[model samples]
Target chain A: MDNQTISPRQFMFLVILFSVGSSILIVPTPLAANAKQDAWISISISVAIGLLLVVLYNHIATLMKGQTFVQATIAVFGNWFGRVLLFFYLSFLYILASLVLRNIGDFMTTQIIPETPLQFTHILFLIVVIWGAYLGLEAIGRSSEMFMPWVVLLVFFFTITLSPQIKMENLQPVLGNGIVPVVDTSTFVIGTPLLEMVTFLMIIPYVKDGKTKKRAWILGTFIGGAILTLITLLCILILGSDLTALNTYPSYKLAQKINIAGFLEGLEIIIAIIWMITIFFKMVVLYYSTTVGIAQFLTMEDHRPLLLPLGMGMVVLSIIAYPDVAYFETFINETWFPFAITHGLIIPLIVWIGLLFKSKKQNKTQQEPS
Target chain B: MWSMISIIVLALGIFLLEFPKLYKKNRKKEAWFFTIFLLSFTIISVLESLEVELPNPLDLIQTFYKMIGF
Candidate 1:
């Protein structure tokens, strides 16, 4: 909105970081619980579904080039209804940012710093998120480029170092529980993490090149989804299905299991830092989208005026959102799936269809005039 | 007591950081909105610090999930 655009490469890295975000630590356990040894299958299915979603979002972006998702929604839906949809979109993104903030807070307080109050972690983290966003998307994009290599290297290190613990026996009897569980877990994967790429609809317009934009979305989704799949597979192979399912942060547990000589025993710190860095990128991107989306919805010329206040709102709402991680996980499993479908899939599909009709009508009008 | 103090201090810091830019740009409406937003958070923090019960929005969502048999 400020005439700032991120390069396609930065967009790709952002996608990779955002998709990996908390999922590295959060997704493995749930997938393990549902799909057991076949959790990787769930991830693969979600990746396929996620790629299609990227295509759908790219199609919509092509239809409404040179506009943020909010502007494009208004263009298609007209004023009042469009305004309503904009509010819905804003709520979706804001809730997402708040939930992610809550997640980092939960992770830190429960796992990393048990003595520290959750509020402290939320506030401390939001400070950076607000600052990164205040510098604008370019700064965020550039920062992601700076951090991506280190994050990737750390992940690879964890994976290779933990290779000794991976037992082929852990993946025995493939599809032992039948496809139901895999499908069920894949639904969770699709609804929660993958379809959450819908937020990128708000982001893709900022890519400077059209060709680069298309490739970035498609390639980024697959690469990101692939990373998640690998992580899930690693968790299953190393920790076994029961331990993977039992531990809340199975990937973190896998990190803990990296006992390559006694010297490298406690490497969860690297995993924590990796999660923090990726989550920071994800939260900032979502927070920036919410602020810009709201400012546009309100017809404000500058979004800066709203950044800090909305950040305050994010911190407070995060506190108000979940009583504890257990409830939070339950909400994800039960409520989040349908909610994601409505916002992520159904809403965007409706808008795209509306755009199609609008384009056809305009073409007909031009033909009649000619 | 500590939480309340911290909330006030944080709110003040936010005001200090952001208010000048708004004042410099003559953005009165934005200034008021920011102040109000900070004030509301302060109140919530104070209430939370005092251990007063407050309804959480996420609970409402959970209730909706139950109502839908989810």
Candidate 2:
């Protein structure tokens, strides 16, 4: 594969965008349902844990020494076993890309344009995602840099406009339940956009400068988690835990609550725009990783050729990803956390352990030869 | 029927757009890989357009996790 490098700054922006991704819209609902008024605390705890996860990912990247995650697996595990393990990893990445695509389709169809067929939305969004993937990581990174300011500004305005609606009573009885629920909710939070940072292992090696790569990864995650926490806190404060938990898209509803003296009523489109931009980057990152993973797996020269076909496949997979919204919710609440942990934590931990053994063996051989 | 036709046309369009470049470069391996992926995805798209009851991979994951009591 030819070299494509993105500066650590651009890498940071991508991390921030990807971390914020679809979580901004949907995370509040589950968090509020589980943790009630303490949902923000749940997110805060997850952010701290997420930082530690980033450190683990950085250690894996340091060991990789410029190899993509796909290549690293093969180097660490030998060809056949690595490829077997990689098949599972690649499937997870591919399914995740489709799932993200399906999310856009689901949101747009249900919320914005109810009349549009879900497949049409998927195809339309997939076209842009495919284009971004074909342009490669450098392009994806540059675009994230360009779009980061708008995301930040929209999120800031979103929080500021809705501040007046916040009821202190909404957050009363902070620990009314217990710490267990808070910790439990935090695990769910960690499962999502946090653990999914494993995908960044594919892109981290492409980032120039080792120290900045680590710094950018952690900083980007911090900012992203902060944005999510603020949004979740706003959801609880403005809409109250019950309504926030009940609604599928509380953050969007929070945006709609921005009346601004009755003149600015329907700025929910701001939420839509923010979600579109952030999810677009998120899907692009996931789609890029899937394509690159497949290309590297097959030992192909360029990943570009696989983009269009996979894009089509993703549309179909997404359509069938969840039969309905209820199933999606159940999958998220129950299955997603363990599944994510397996791929995001356990497998990488095994790879890290393998690296240690390999280094130790190399040291022993060198000493014996001397 | 129209959905099926559209799916096929879309696949063919992608093929036309990408195949020549791969062919020109004589990257035979990539060309073959692309053809296989395009063919398989095209077939799946057709099946999906037909509303065939294809199995969902996520069900398998859920089942496996449930079996393991996670």
Candidate 3:
């Protein structure tokens, strides 16, 4: 497992890319719908909460220093229960990956390439993801390092180019409706993307230097969350809260609004490119983790064989995942918050407690022998 | 019909490319998993492309949500 180690810097880029993921294009609309003018504040709160989750995930990673999340689960619980839990966790990851695939597929069909069928878009994306995962984490890590700089530059480009449309009055009356909406929005924001850092636990063991592991996790999460917050602020500023909330892809629309003396009139291509790259990274991370985790759980020597079949399953799952965009939105709005909390927060919390007791017992036994 | 044939051809191409290695490695269980998964996906894609109605996975979650009164 340690045969393929990635540098801390690459790890950080992966985290940033993973956190940005599919959430970048779509997250702001929900934030604006929930928090209105206070969307930025909601995102800020999510960042804070996200950092806290990073800490908790780091603690669990530290407790079982060299084990993947699946290994840790099996170590904490006996094999039978652990296998059951691992199965459930892996299932959750696969479902999430499929949904993400569906997201980009939906984005392409509805927003960019309406004439192209959704399955083609999905199959094309999955092909890249399958190949990336086949190359394994090291390649994915290096790819992130190479691409993250451009992603950052593009983000800044959007921020600066769209500056003319930003209205200070749009963000006026902050907390005028009190902090309820802000808090409400924060839960959705944090639960959806921030706490999804739980998935990173599976990759933590591959970091070369244990000392820098926690720092990379925290820094990556914070940087990613900050970018999200900045984008949320930009959405609110440029489009105003009402319009931002109304649009499906607020950031994409915001990109369309970028008119730098008519030179960059149609910048949605740039936004689409950003989304494709980030979602590719995101899906690869999730897909890699899912395939590798399944291989490990099943005691298979190679995860590559699982990729194509599982990738196919994912395409089908993505199709069946939602009947339409409206149902998808309803899932995000209603069920996803609790679902994310249960998997991301509650399960990890239990495992952490179990780890604490297991460590304590080990310490006591070691002391008695001494 | 054309899309369905293309999907089947694609599945067969991928199967031939991938399965030999797994067979040489003596990974029978994995090979079987791959075979079944690929076959099912091909069928689903063909059915979907043909506009045949199929059960959706989303409704399961929706049912769970309803049960929980969410």
Candidate 4:
């Protein structure tokens, strides 16, 4: 009878697809550049952070039982304060959604459809987001379910196809630049993408198998991180750390580099399709989540009606928000990690701690019978 | 501007589509807030599409990050 229940396997699929979305496209190169061939080291460090977030998300979810993170906020903060906190959360989510849309739009223009107007792809992407949202959470869930196999299959193909080009010599003297740069890059690498799991709190309460949620989140993150680590490792081997960081889509480039005795060339186009599909799933998740969050914040029963305009708005916002790719690059490097941490990590931690104390106090009160 | 026409169309379309769901006595205050919130996004989207000058609130914030060197 519980409508909100989502199986752990389904949740895992969502996590993997969602986790790989934008991060896979842009993160590998710079992270490799930053830490040299030891980029996987940074990924490992970031993945540890992902594990921490699993604990945090599970802690909050278990406390709230079957309610979403939004409901839990009210439980923690009461109506007025909870509502206010929710507004902030909603705003952050909205920004994240818009940023993702922008990133995907820019990526599209640069790579996939250079001649097509950015607005066209951005708007089309948002249309998919609206369609997903309008069809309801169940549609979003099912779509992720359907996309999971393709996403996973393509990832393996992408990795294996690039195998011939991989040069073990490229990985010589791993951590060649000393641990300092690795550590510095680790903060962003681990902090930004892995740190993003804090948003899972929003989905936590809606997750069934509450006891197994921690396991689901941890395993899911590890699976996603493993894919990323493999990709980064391959990127280093194929392109060398120097060349890897120069290209925007290193994995795509890796696919392009494949010739396989002239049997398989221009695999990058195929990889781009896979990348776009996974990215769309991720964007839709974020967009649906933001709409749901805002609807709940504003006390709306259905977020469906708001989806179209929000999607439309996001496409436009994507263009205006950053001056160009360089500015966008700078914002991500210099700006995003910290903001992501505060909103995605620290604030959620505060919510968890608040819930913990409140639960403890409630337990005490119940025991005392006062 | 063309953006104005687009914004009006979007806002009007949303108001029409959502009015039935939105204008109910059983509705929560948040429903009203979300409706308006969404409507405002339409305006923001239109102005942004038109390439209107909007404040970059993150400049100072980003500058600090650059200075700190992350």
Error at B68, model 2, angstroms: 0.3
Per-residue alpha-carbon lDDT of model 3 for A111-215, expressed as tens digits? 988999788899899999999999988999999988999999999898888887779999999897899989988888787788777888889899889888789
Sort order, lDDT high to low? 2, 3, 1, 4
Predictions in order: lDDT? 0.85, 0.91, 0.86, 0.75
Standalone chain B TM-score for every prediction: 0.82, 0.98, 0.90, 0.61
In DockQ, how does model 3 score against the reference complex? 0.54
When only the first chain is scored, the TM-scores of the models are: 0.98, 0.98, 0.98, 0.95
lDDT of 1 at A113: 92
Residue B33 Cα positional deviation in candidate 3, in Å, after optimal superposition: 3.6
User: Native contacts retained by model 1, as a fraction?
Assistant: 0.49
Chain A of candidate 1 gets a TM-score of: 0.98
Query: What is the Å distance of residue A263 in model 1 from its true position?
Result: 2.3
Tens-digit lDDT track of model 1 for A197-273: 88888788888889887898788888888888888899889889999989988888888887877876788898999
In model 1, where do residues sit more than 4 Å from their true spots? Answer: B32-36, B65-69
Error of 3 at A94 (Å): 0.5
Best by DockQ: 2
True contacts kept of each: 0.49, 0.89, 0.49, 0.51
| Alpha-carbon lDDT of model 1 | 0.85
How big is the positional error of residue A100 in model 2, measured in Å on the Cα after superposition? 1.0
Q: Candidate 4 i-RMS (Å)?
A: 2.9
**Candidate 1 residue lDDT tens string, B1-70:** 8777877787788789888988898977767767776778677767877878778766776687678777
